[model samples]
Target: MDIRIGIKDSAREIAFDSAQSPKEVEEAVVAALDSGHLTLDDAKGRRYIVPSAGIAYVEIGSESTRKIGFVA
Candidate 1:
């Protein structure tokens, strides 16, 4: 799975194998959810909070972007 992480006011791409054990990923996701720094309604609702970064936001797969063959 490809995921984006926010680091020091910037976003970076991360890759995780979908076939790996789900435990670590699940734990990370849960921790992120509990952090409360990620608001589901920020930047028109495309951002989430990560422990290492203040905010993790994505602008991928939008209608216009998709039409132009861009994948985020």
Candidate 2:
């Protein structure tokens, strides 16, 4: 299984093959925000503002690559 992370402004991508849970993904996002690498806004105490400036993707198992599409 390969997971790829893409950025809209750059052609290079970051790929990882380790398995991670959904919670791990969330934790990573939070860590990125805290580190000032990612911008996240809070709304209604439970909502988060996801930046759409860059493109991200993840591949699970042997299926085709999936884009990380999120609603604003």
Candidate 3:
């Protein structure tokens, strides 16, 4: 799944791909916001952490299969 995190005062948002489910991601975000910190592990084993207060919003993209080549 593709996740986009909007940071306060930043023009560019953080984007990453995670293997976790949408519900799990949402829960984690909510938990982090409530606790003042957000941490997430991506499918590639990379960790992302940010202050919940600094987060403007979180956009969760739908999981889609990668397509190659052009289709008529």
Candidate 4:
């Protein structure tokens, strides 16, 4: 799934593809908002941690099946 995180006062948003399910992502965001920060791992294994206070908006894109190779 494609996730876009908007930071407060920032022009560009942090975006990445996560291997996590929608429910898991939602849980993480909710926990972060209540706890302190948001943390999620991308499909590449890189982990992202952002302060919840600095989060402007969170855009969760619809999950789509990845296409492989060319089609006729």
Q: Candidate 1, clashing residue pairs? A: none
Q: What lDDT is reached at residue 66 by model 4?
A: 75
Q: Per the 3 Å backbone cut-off, how many clashing residue pairs does candidate 3 have? A: 0
Question: Per lDDT, what order, best first?
Answer: 4, 3, 2, 1
Better of 1 and 3 by TM-score: 3
The predicted structure with the larger TM-score, 1 or 2, is 2
The lDDT per prediction is 0.40, 0.48, 0.94, 0.95
The TM-score between candidate 3 and the true structure equals 0.90
- For each candidate in turn, give its C-alpha RMSD to the true structure in angstroms: 11.6, 14.0, 1.3, 1.7
Error of 2 at 61 (Å): 7.8
lDDT of 1 by residue, 1-67 (tens): 3344445555464322232233544455556666754322233334443454454543222222225
Show the lowest summed lDDT stretch of 10 residues, model 2.
39-48
Q: Write the per-residue lDDT of candidate 4 for residues 1-72, one digit (tens) a residue.
A: 999999999999999999998889989999999999999999999999999999998888889997899988
Per-residue lDDT for 4 in model 4? 96
Worst 10 residues of 3 by lDDT: 33-42
Better of 2 and 3 by TM-score: 3
